[model samples]
Target: MSGERARILVVDDEKVIRDSCTRILTTEGHIIKSAENGNIGLEVFREFHPDLVLVDLKMPGKSGMDVLEEIESIDPNVVQIVITGYATVSSAVDAMKRGAYDFIPKPFTPEEILLIVGRGLEKRRLLLESEALKVEHERIRRNMISLVSHELRAPLAATVQYLEVILGGMAGEIPSEAKEMIVRCDIRLQEMLELLRKWLNLATFDSPKMAEHFQDISLSDIATESIELMKSLAEEKKISLILETSKDLPPIKGSKVSLEEIFNNLISNAIKYNKAGGWVKVILYGREEEVWVEISDNGSGIDEEHLSRIFDEFYRVDGRRNAPIKGSGLGLSIVKKMVDAHGGMIDVESKFGEGTTFRIGFPKFFQRQKEG
Candidate 1:
């Protein structure tokens, strides 16, 4: 029905029915995979990952219902259609409730089968598109929050500092315990202010103007400075910070500020998430035409599932786990965006309870620089 040709899986105990359905679908320019039993159908499902599954209701070993359950468990997005000669009203309704896209009665015409399969494929496409849009909308919303948070930081910092000055007797003397309470207020205010600043920086990078300001910058200098600046914070946590860089590395065309921000956020995160007496090692090297910078920390590693989504704005796994680490969760997101803006890529390798490593690559030459 759509411009996209679909892959279809036809599973039935009867070879004649299976071949007939496969032949019809194949003639319609659809890629078809066939299985004569429910067990083999599940294996084919995993391997083919078809756009639509046509399951016979009553197969040996595993019924269509059982196979449908397994498919739903593996990937809920797959559109399934129940094919049955025993298509009583109850059976049809039961199949629909069990996540079948539609129920097809057996001894059906080729036209009937084709119509059902086409509609199922269309539904699958719509579902996938909807899911993609949902993710995009969520990402945009998070980016907006990150941007607004950043914009709020400067004013917040000024307000907090002025309040601190007033409480510190710069303007007038305050009561003793009142001063203690004000001090606590100032601490919380400062923490909020820091979070706001991080959000603001994250937001700024999202802007086209800020994203465009990238050029060739020395990786070694950036790495060294970032590590040095974070040394104190790591020391406070009793974490050892180490830097290992290849001497005279090739310069990458990227925003110095963005690179600085990237490294600063990464190192800060490493220190923030690390256990006491842990170690953070930053290594910089060049391979062929690309420069690589990797930051590794002996902190609590993120789960494999989370590593893929950690770059999403405000995605905080630790916070979800009720860990004490304080952050706005925009750091990794910003890092990813900035690196992408610079025509680069970033990856994470981590193991739970051991540690995490964030590796980012930069191209030696940026297309934007050549254009300019």
Candidate 2:
């Protein structure tokens, strides 16, 4: 049995063939439109907007081949089946290549017409169902990520606060050994918090709600703010944080939070992975069409092979994974998605012993800018 009633268009120059196809298919629970000539076939096809089209291979005026070409130009996804008395392997092959789903020979039986039409419609149903499943899977995956991250956030945040008080000796007198253990626990909890936050941010990154907050933003200002926030981390490792920017970088269009996030993730990683006394440089420049920001770090550089897959979700470079680097491997993944959403470009340059640099460019567009 067919999965669903499909809207079908029958385009054959012969009245008998077109009428027979319509009678057989319409009886099989489909809405059918029949056209008597090649030119009319193309017209009806566009107006019908059918799930399947049954077109003859040869016809007068425009010819079935010409109709097929026009139909392909209109919407290639519309399933087309060819009808022809001159059935040959070469002709069938040509028809199929030109986007025909199946071929019907002359004098096809009622059963044959139904069977072939049913097969083509079934293919359409499966393709739609497969795509729906994929969308559902992604929805579930993101929902789970969001749910877990938010649920764990409160307790983890409280834990960090209380741990801080205790470590600061505000709770009471504690032994040095116990303080050391608590510090370790606190570090682990902080790491977990970072992971949860990233997960939550990633889940909401591409949401339509977030897109509403986009506005013209200062690239240099955001870069300066991110640098200030990461200064302590860089100082702890004795790493130099350098900022080089053209003061006149043109404002680019994007969610301010998203742009700031890009700065945070890239700068944070540069500092985290750098050796003591290393330097991380952030450069912001403006081209005619877009604004570009580059974050470079002279630290433990990424390997050649790892560079390609670095932006992939939850994938860690072998060096970063084996080394003491701390991350959920989702930072660059988030960065890449955000860049793509802005219709921007991102590039990476690295050599194992030298260093790594990440450059990102955002398109310049002012669409009802707001003061931020």
TM-score per model over all chains: 0.57, 0.72
**Candidate 2 has which clashing residue pairs, if any?**
none
Question: lDDT by residue for model 2 over 99-216, one digit each (tens)?
Answer: 7888989999999998898898887776667777999999998778856765688878988999999999998999999999999999989988988888777776653556577777
Q: Sum up the clashes in candidate 1.
A: 5
What would you estimate as the lDDT of candidate 1? 0.85
The weakest ten consecutive residues by lDDT in model 2 span 363-372
- TM-score result, candidate 1: 0.57
Off by over 4 Å in 1: 1-155, 204-208, 369-372
Residue 339's lDDT within candidate 1 is 90
Model 2 regions lying over 4 Å from their true place: 1-19, 22-116, 161-176, 319-322, 366-372
Q: Report the C-alpha lDDT of model 1 over 242-312, residue by residue, as the tens digit.
A: 88889789998777888899999999988988899999999999999899989999898999888878999
